[model samples]
Target: AVRIVNKRGQFMQEAVPVGEGSMAAILGLDSDKIVEICRSVEAESGEAVQAVNFNCPGQVVIAGAVNPVNKAIEALKAAGAKRAVLLPVSAPFHSTLMQPAADRLAEVLAPIEIKDITIPVVANVTAQEVTSGEEIKKLLVKQAAMPVLWETSVRNMVAGGVDTFVEVGPGKVLTGFTKKIAKGMTALNVEDAESLEKTLAALGK
Candidate 1:
């Protein structure tokens, strides 16, 4: 899955020339407020930007053409955002600018065989539990051009009785987000051999 997404990202980069597109994180602002500011900026600047990630309450990510994104950042700060910072990404991802890439990815995904999942997967596109393979494939394509409902997905999992979140791989960033998104939830990270051992010990394995 990672391989396919990385491959398709090449096409996404081509859709927007380097430095022409950008993304930013708006902290201490509501998503609705962020969206409204972005739209107003888009209308005035004749460029496009939108709120693309509802990371958690009071935090959202926006992405689009660089000019619009910069405009939106200023607008959001003026509207009471605590901070708005540009992200270190070459292209604006999960925005309408990625539609061309998503279309091409659909073609590449069409021939692949996808088996149904045994464990329910929370879809980033929908923030809902998905079990069927076909739905998963379709969502993957849509995710390229749609906002991520990360906050909603985490809330849904907690409400459904999930109490522990173990983030494996390079960073503990998601674990930090999990802690902020849900109080009293156990968040763990396994980024190295020591951390893996600690995680196992904590889980009583």
Candidate 2:
């Protein structure tokens, strides 16, 4: 995973110049309204701004060129968004602007040895479980430049009888999202040894 992500980071840098693109989180707005606002911003500015991340209900992230990103932020605020804030990041990820990066990543992945996994994995681009190696490979490439259907992915898992989610590694942002996305579902995070212990105890229950 590290090897794959390292190349992805390099290609992301090459895809867009530093400071040329930006990302913003739009809070307390429906996804449909956010999409409509992004369309208006793109038409007016003739730049690329898209609703990229559907993190949860009322929480969407947009990414594109700096000008349009900011324009969308203002418009979202005026459209009655609770908070539309610019994110501190170097690149506009998971937007059409990252197509170049996706293209590069495709080339890098074509020849690598990727075997099919037995366990199901929900793809970010399609919001569906993909088990075939080839299908997973294609989805991974598209994920770089496509909107992440995180909310849909989580709901799919809920429908599949997954009532508990254990997020390994750092951060509780996903744990928060799961709580909001699937109310009453158990969400646990393991960021350190102590957290891991707690997570295991919770799972044992």
- Using TM-score as the measure, the top candidate is 2
lDDT, residue 168, candidate 1: 91
lDDT per prediction? 0.90, 0.93
lDDT of 1 by residue, 53-139 (tens): 888888899999988898888888889999998999988889988999899899889999789999999997999999999998999
Residue 84 error, candidate 2, Å:
0.7
* Model 2 lDDT at residue 38: 98
Residue 74 C-alpha lDDT in model 2: 92
- Which candidate should be chosen as best, given lDDT against the real structure? 2
User: Model 2's lDDT to the true fold?
Assistant: 0.93
Candidate 1 wrongly placed segments (more than 4 Å): none
The CA root-mean-square deviation of candidate 1, after full C-alpha superposition on the true structure, stands at: 1.3
Off by over 4 Å in 2: none
